[model samples]
Target: MLEIKDVAFGGKAVGRLEDGRVCFSPDALPGERVQVTVTRETKRFVEAQLDRVLEASPRRVKPPCPYYGACGGCSYQHAAYDYQVELKTKQVGDVLGRLGGIENPNVLEGVPSPLPYGYRNRITVHRHGGRIGFHRRDGKGLVDIEACLLASDEVNKRLAELRRERFHEGARVLREHASRMGFHQTNDGVGALLQDAVSEACGSGGCLIDAYCGDGFFAHRLAKKFQRVIGLEWNERSIAQARSVAHANESYIEGDVAARLAEVLEEADGAATTVILDPPSQGLDVQVADLLRAYPVAKIVYVSCNPATLARDLKSLAAVYELGSATPFDMFPQTAEVEVLAILRRRF
Candidate 1:
């Protein structure tokens, strides 16, 4: 059995074994004395599971979810909401300070979800044989979930209906397609909220270019505020859907964003422009960064999932632009993940 010592980097407790090796345990908070059974002893660190609480931390509370321990959806649902926010804030600060080499970075308070429970717009439910739910945290076993507290009511309702039907290969395709279309209610209406933030930041009557604008989610909304809105997307299926819903004035081009940006810039020709980038987690390529720097855009709104990559790209862009403000959105509550939107303006 191991005793909890202090909070480690990834929200786990760091403890040492008698043999002079380190160990880590989940569900074991800092300042709590717990007896943990060693599950696996590795060369560097040992993995353990909580066996008994010799002494529980005051921050510990009853987990609301029925499948808290088994389901991989959430980790901190066992802790109180306020404490969860505090932990997340610390995580963001730590990553930026330690990894990004940014000292005492001003991490704005995280934007809280409108409704913590039942706020997810999308949920990918796994299916193998008759089982349909999330995979177990440790084992290959599947935990069949009838109701998910974090998923929207629409997803839960659709899941219930889908379960009644016999499992077929075609059902998986249909479910996956539906989930990607954003049919469920999300926290703070994520799509609308992002669009509103962009609009407010950009102000009225200017050309706006969106990169990786999936299904015209933000482009459609920005069309109302901008004089002209152009969206670049690679997915033909998403482009088709976007075209179907796109406003008459809004234009969407189906191609690589990096390749199309040059053409868009040539066409715009020094018109007041604002670029909104929502790239993948790997972050923008060097070529893309080069093109963005070359373009005479007035401002850039970079939305990123990985802060490490964001910091790298921001350093590159810092040659021409100055950091304005950063706002973090808690899209994923449980894990060590956060979505941040940073606004950058030309230094001149």
Candidate 2:
């Protein structure tokens, strides 16, 4: 059994073992003394589950989800909502300062999600055998979940209907064949809020080029703010969706982003462009990085899910563009992941 000591980086409790090694315990908050059972141990640290809370922190709250600890989908739902925001902000600041080498950087206050719960627009329910839900934190077990508090009501209703159809029977097959394309919108109101923020930051009188544009989300919304909007996406389904929503003033191309941007720029008639890139957690491809540096865009807005990769990409892009501001968004409130929105202007 382990006793909780203090809070560690990922909102887990840091406690030392009898042999002087460290263990990280989830569901054990700071200022709380708990008896924990070591589930898995490693040479450096250990992973534990809370066995008993000898002393409880005042910040602890009742988690509304029944599958809270069993399902790894949400970790900090037991923590206070306000405290969740605080921890996320600190995590972003630490990543920027420690990894990005931006000391004393002006980190904007996190853009809080309008509705923290039931905000997720999309959810991937995994099914192996008769089980369907998220995998356990230990990555070894599966917990069947009937409903997810994080998913939007619409998605939940759809999920229920899908389940009634016994969709889990051929989940793997359906997932493979599903067009994998649809309008991407956060069931939560955060997408709209993010659109507003991007619009306000970029302002008017500039062309906006969105790389990695999925279904032309921001491209469709922000086309009015710019003299012209051009979107580049690799997914054919997403490209088709974008085309369906495209106005006469907006254009979208389907091809590899790094390879196709040069041609897209040439076709733009030398318009000054503001580039907004929202890449996956793997971050930007090196080839794309080179293109951004070579082309002189007015401003670049980079939206990223992983801080470590974002820092690395920013460090590489710093040579060509001046990093103006960074705002972290708590898109995934309960998890360690954060969404960082960075604004960069081309150097003269």
lDDT by candidate, in order shown: 0.74, 0.77
Q: Which tens-of-lDDT digit does each residue in 69-142 have in candidate 2?
A: 77877778888877777667776777777777777656788887778797886777777777877788768867
Candidate 1: residue pairs that collide: none
Cα misplacement distance, residue 302 of candidate 2 (Å): 1.1
Q: What TM-score against the true fold does each predicted structure earn?
A: 0.82, 0.86
Decoy 1 TM-score against native: 0.82
True-vs-predicted CA distance for residue 157, candidate 2, Å? 2.4
Query: What are the runs in model 2 whose C-alpha is more than 4 Å off?
Result: 1-11, 15-22, 39-44, 168-180, 265-271
Candidate 1 lDDT over 1-348, as tens digits, reads 566776554557778888978888888776777888889888988888888888887888888888888987677776666666666666666666666555676677776555667777567777876788887877776788897888777768878987897765322422323636522223445545666676677675778888888887777877888888898988887788888888878989998987888899878744488888888888888878888777767888887777778777877776777667766766666555667777888887
Q: How much is 63 displaced in model 2, in angstroms?
A: 1.1
Q: Which stretches of candidate 1 lie over 4 Å from their true place?
A: 1-23, 38-47, 169-188, 245-249, 266-271
Worst 10 residues of 1 by lDDT: 168-177
